[model samples]
Target: MTHAQTQESNHLQRGLKVEQKKILDTLLQSVYRQEGWVFFVYGSGGIGKTYLWRALISKLRSENHIVLAVASSGIASLLLPGGRTTHSRFKIPFALNEYSCCNIDQGSDLAHLIEKASLIIWDEAPTAHRHAFEAVDRTFRDIMQLRHPTSMEKVFGGKVVVLGGDFGQILPVVKKVGRADVIDASISKSLTIWPHCTVFKLETNMRLLQRDGKLPAIAKEGEDEPMWINIPDDLLIKAREDSIDEMVESVYLDLLQEYTNPTYLQQRAILTSKYDMVDKINDHILKMIPGGEKVYKRADRVCPITKTGVNVEALCPTEFLNTLQLPGIPNRELKLKVGCP
Candidate 1:
């Protein structure tokens, strides 16, 4: 391997903790040696789920096992040639539909790909649809003919699938899949008694700063932290407005002292929107600045407004112009210049 690859492999191997080591050992023994293992490692966000999978893959590679790591986010980056979304991987549409065995052929390539892999690590799996999982399994079984008793019964059929993700972050957007969904699906397959299928929970917050007493306890199972402060809306709004004004004044003074030319002052004022409302306060600055020269030129401004409704269409100003809503906002579109003085 190249120097970069060697360094990355070494780094991944070195990052494995005690529990991660135990999990990796169990997975290697059960999934590698046995057939049809679907191992899941679930945890809360920022809890090192991806790190553990990377470490496992590195370890497996060191032992001469072929590994493929895939995720919903980095489909293009993770997939060889080009990564694909989870939906594309399973040959499912963005919208969920009824489960059908007919769609199995659509996922033939993925099935063949997985059949050749020794270990298939699917990260961010919680966002995958339940039907998508079933479709993938059925497709693989059909394509590889692994479901048949005549086909290499002792070879473990295909790749051992390892799924890792945080169920709490976000469930499947197309179709909801939770602990109950996993249980129901497993029971349906008559593989519930099989030891190869197991759920492993990883509990520990290694990402957050522990010095903050408000931080949630790093445990496998516990109650969430309670809210300590609650303020009324009126006071909150006033405080925010005061803070914005203070920030805007600071930016104005800084620009006056620092910039000698009008162009530089315009640029500085434009950058000051981080403190106050960009459109409202910036427009005032553009008009007030010397030379009657707007920070944004007339040609630089573009209108973005859309009309709605077929029969009773009405004009609605864009966000840049409309700051507050009175009541009963109508569906309409009104064109207005951006950076207008």
Candidate 2:
């Protein structure tokens, strides 16, 4: 059986969801069957690219066809699942220089191995260099020693390459590939005679929820559609206020019985003016509250300490303490000695 057949078989056994099954069926029937075809699956993040890729690989492997899956990010994770980097899988050199050629070295086992491979699935293809892809294609043609039209006629020569990525995230670090970058480049425009590639956009976002209990509306096919949601400023401000109020109430309740002093209550009230102020005051309160004790003592437990020479000592065993430093005061030190060490 071919690798595609094997993958489909496995997917059937696993019993994927309706949407997932639809995606798989579309890929198998529409994309994989085509030779010399470049299938691009563009979707939002967390919409299940990795899951689909695994299913595809499983089906392809079951068909007894070679499947090479490569990822741009999470190299270790990909390797754990038995995949390789696109560059390594294609046997393309890292540095592109004047001397660099598309032809793979003769007698190289790696080149021969890939030449016999059935399919190559490149994840995060948005980050892949156009030159790198071209080089790989050239190398494949060279390895087989077949001329154009004839050499590219066979399945491997006519190999199916599936490119998957979310274009919304990061683009290629070395060379950009996608609609915007290609359209911007004059050279890319000149080289294109006929559009041979079939671009498929994944419309349904399986990640976020919409206001109407449906999936977030994503542009199935268009350049002008907005990818991100535009939240209103008023709504955002209201959410912030609500969240702050809840946090302040929770903290106040936790410290209610402990710090009974009116001054402490005033300080806590002042700290709630902003989130940053709350954090600063909380840190201060935590420091004042002795470790291992949930409650904080009243300020009456604190005893004023006067620093004498370099040595300073506590006069009373106070449970609560707050250190204060004042300028122009004798010894310039004011320590609220506490009972707890």
- Top of the candidates by TM-score: 1
lDDT of 2 by residue, 233-341 (tens): 5334343543644545544665635465665465444335454464455555556555454443334343244454332225544322233323432221222324322
Model 1 regions lying over 4 Å from their true place: 1-4, 30-34, 61-64, 73-84, 95-98, 101-110, 146-158, 174-196, 209-341
Model 1 global lDDT (CA atoms, 0 to 1): 0.55
| TM-score of every candidate | 0.55, 0.51
Clashes of each: 6, 16
- Deviation of model 2 at 296, angstroms: 35
Residue ranges of candidate 2 with Cα displaced over 4 Å: 1-23, 29-34, 74-80, 97-103, 146-149, 152-156, 174-194, 209-341
lDDT of 1 by residue, 92-173 (tens): 5554433533244524665556656677676777665555555555555565565454333322245477777776565655
